[model samples]
Target: MRTIAYFLVITLICCLAPSADLSAQLNEPAPIRLRNASFEDIPRNSRAPVGWYNCGFPAETPPDVHPDPMNQFQVGMGPQHGRTYLGMVVRDNDTWESVGQELSEPLVAGQCYDFWINLARSKVYLSQSRVSNKPANYVTPAKLRIHAGYDFCDRQELIGESDMVRNYNWQEYAIKLSPTEDYTHLVFEVFYETPTLIPYNGNLLLDNASTLIPSPCEEVVAVNSPLVNDDQKEPISTDPVPGPVVVTQPTTKSGDPQPDPEPQVQLGQSKQVLAVDAVFEVPDITFVANESELTPESSASLQEIVDFLTIYDNVIIEIGGHASQKATADFANRVSMRRAGSVVEYLRTRGIDPRRMFPKGYGKSKPVCYDESADCKRRNQRVDVKVLKIE
Candidate 1:
């Protein structure tokens, strides 16, 4: 009789376990999501992308949706991803362009997030200068400023700022954000090199943004991590996203750690010919959470594949997107399939022949690692290239 009662108790606990899990899930905070994150829209001058609101300086022109196709400003760089990218300029008159959006969820206070965005420069951003009426090429490099605010265009606190983005090639920048207060809006804006008395014409190109993935406070480089410092003082304000806010607080007293230096990856390297069945693992592929879009940093490795294909013209290949073990086989398959399709689309934009490439998804059946830790799971989420045929 005691054995039967023990079995009944075990069954009761098992029945309630699912309900407890569901309740915990319901109590979790909703992730903050950005709308139209890739900035896809009709390319136009002085227009913000579809979902982002224009928050440029008062009376100044708004940020631009680039690759205008008409090429009025002499800027015609193709986007790293999607149809159009963003073009923001810091004018000689000290004004700049920016754009903003309300978050899907408010950023909680004292939360640390790992944010990533792709930034580049246009060498031929021709526009009439505010200082001189003649057309000036906005070729100088500029920095990026990200901000969180209570309302549209309100600069409540500066979250992330970047060094001068000098590379013309697209590269992903990981910006660490530490917010002290809960906020609902985020802004991205362009600013000039710091410690300069005079502002000059400069341009910044933006594409392929990542969602703010919650991260351990001690990972990578620490920028504005509240865990490191005890005081609640504001670091020097470079500028906020959407617009530049005049700094009202004191700048850091020299000893505080500066932002991590910009990452540099040389593009356009030659590659050896790939034979059939040769599997090449791309080391830099990172995607937005739950989305298949490749981050800008993936360009470095993706370019190698392009170079390989361009040289070995007869090689046919398969692109496979793999995911970690999921709840069901069908769910894993669908996720991997979408990721593979996104890579194919990116290659197509770069002039790769669609006929020579096949997209496949491996799902959880093939994980690079089975440890099941978060880092290991991230490693398991990957894209692989297999030479299918050598025509």
Candidate 2:
């Protein structure tokens, strides 16, 4: 009778196990917990904050927990929330740091979620060099990118990003996600301006990450054809089978073909690029005394030229370089050539076709202001982009 009782007890325990497991599963949270969301739970003597792990390679160092009291890493400012935040660096060796965590629950498909995080960058950052084995060089600010993914470690979907965050104060950034598939992970990374070509040491601070909340789906409006008549009635079909509706492409009238529409280009301001003809002076492209390299100011002006040429693909321009009277004619000509070449190279880097651009050096032959005053000299040392051809 005792042996029989033991067998019955074993059977009862087995029967209750599955139900208990199901109950626990049902009680699990639907939304992600966003563990260590504020990054307040850091442990002493550790590079990474609690509940977060390095998403980079095994050799790569994890992100540092900061308000670094020992002055090992310079954050320039305090954390945005709590007493600490996470900091990641992109070193000169092309290796960047990233941190990530698995969400408490996976994101559901077809759901819109509102997510936000606080981001900041130090004006400067210092680190130890792997090559020199001494204190590494300090670098300027870079951008930060946040990614989301379904897998724990593979965060391939970019959710939010910032242009070079050079500010010392913390700034809040938000991104809305309309996920197609269930995503369960988030990653924060530091990157240079041009990630593939340039590798520089820069620091990015992350803190006060907000939990994802369900957002309302965007409403879409249906556009009806202007040609459709509201009072028109459909004729009763005599045949049982219906024919497929055919869409006709728009065509020009035979004798009077309409010209293609003028391309619209939005520089800092909006403008229309017509096929006829136009001329605009690039007055801001001023160079430092005889230097062929573009300064930060010159780069901004050149970027405007790039934007203009990009939209008007059929347009061709001559990049004319000039110099001040301080240099000899031969020296000035060479300097001018170099300056023109520099502008062409910059435009090429910006994805403009080289064939459409012509670079010429004027050698101070053509000056907007011919006087010998400082203002005139500055005006003479300029690059002019003249529209040569437009289709």
Show how many residue pairs clash in every candidate, following the order shown.
0, 0
Badly placed stretches (over 4 Å) of model 1 are 1-30, 221-391
Candidate 1 residue lDDT tens string, 157-242? 88888767776666666687888899999888899889878999999999978767665466754232111123732222232232
lDDT of 2 by residue, 1-391 (tens): 9999999999999976666535543433233447667775331223666667778657877777777656666554677776668887877777788878887778776766666667666665677776566886455566677687966567767765655655456666555656666778878778787645756667777888776766545832121111223465221222112122222222233223234344444343325464344435576786666578787787777767865664355678888888887779999999999999989998988767899888999997887776779898887887766668876
**CA lDDT scores, all candidates in order:** 0.74, 0.66
RMSD of model 1 against the true structure: 19.1
Model 2 accuracy (lDDT, Cα): 0.66
RMSD of each: 19.1, 26.4
The pairs that clash in candidate 2 are none
TM-scores, all candidates, are 0.51, 0.45
